[model samples]
Target: MVSKTDDKKAAPAAAAATAKPEEKKKVVSTIEEDDEFEDFPSADKEVIGWDAVEAAEKELNAWKDSWEDDDNETDFAVLLAAEKKKVSSAMKM
Candidate 1:
């Protein structure tokens, strides 16, 4: 037979079973809590390879001038279409 003290101890366990379970705290994501922002370097520093870049720029300008001279003589739309067809045919091979 169960003792009176054992019955009293058992009463709390039954009461605990009948009580509603505690709700868990909801977790918030860092992305939701903080504003989206990115820190990028400011373009204030003087570039080191300015001379080489300037030389390359001069070369590119001369090339572009020559290309423009050639383009003035040709029908650019026809040239582009022909080049595109050639490229597509080459890709197929």
Candidate 2:
């Protein structure tokens, strides 16, 4: 029974009636303090031994050789980075 102009006017009013007013959230203040512990100093001061470094270098060289052997496949370093991401995500969960 309503004309097109009436329908158009009613549409906006209907929309406005159904529209929800946005809620204003309160600003909350929180204090975040970092506590220092004895273990932290120990962690910061810990020294890496030369023997450990040598062992790590040997293991790294072995891994490099194995990766170089697969020249036809995806790069070895890229695979290592992808594996690292997977491990990091798993730890987060």
Candidate 3:
């Protein structure tokens, strides 16, 4: 029953009816007092022993070796990254 002129007039009304109103959200204040702040545990100030230093060096070497092995394992690290992502997603399910 709507003529072309009537349809044009009704279009704006129909759009206005379906349109959502703008929402005003209250901004949360980020101001913090000294007492409100959490005290983080102080890290060890003492120097680490040679054994500890050696252990860290060994762990770093192991990681570097694994990285090198993976680089040798595939032609492109990009393919490996994609494969790793797929494996991670499958494990999640």
Candidate 4:
């Protein structure tokens, strides 16, 4: 029994009534500290021999050689500076 104009007006109202409410997004706090252990038993750690050190150096060189120039390469000095800045800022906080 509704007219065309009445149906058009009621359509939007019906849609609005049937629409679901937006869900609230979860907020993560940057201030929260991780529960991971900071200090480990370094004094009781096994000492590496020259052979182990040489092997580790060879492995590191191989890993470094695997990187290509297109990997968005960054200078170690720049990265170190950024890390130092972050540490200084955190210390201030």
Residue 36 deviation, candidate 3, in Å? 81
Q: Using lDDT as the measure, name the better of candidate 2 and candidate 4.
A: 4
| TM-scores, all models, native as reference | 0.21, 0.21, 0.21, 0.21
RMSD values, in order shown:
27.3, 29.6, 28.5, 26.7
Superposed Cα deviation of residue 49, candidate 1 (Å): 60
* Tens-place lDDT digits, model 2, residues 1-93: 333444546655555435522211111222222222212222212343465565456443434435346443458768987899999999999
lDDT value, residue 24 of candidate 4: 11
lDDT of each: 0.48, 0.46, 0.47, 0.48
In model 2, residue pairs whose N, Cα or C atoms come closer than 3 Å (at least 3 residues apart or on different chains), thus clashing, are none
Identify the superior model by TM-score, candidate 3 or candidate 4: 4
| Model 1 error, position 70 (Å) | 23
Per residue, candidate 4 scores C-alpha lDDT tens digits across 1-93 of 332544445555555435522211111233333443434323223343366555456443434555545542378857877889999999999
lDDT of 4 at 54: 57
What digit string (tens of lDDT, one per residue) describes model 3 on residues 1-93? 232544555555555435522211111233333325443222221333465565456443434434445353465777888889999999999
Q: Native-vs-model 1 lDDT?
A: 0.48
lDDT score at residue 66, model 3, on the 0-100 scale: 48
- lDDT for position 73 in model 3: 44
Error of 3 at 68 (Å): 7.5
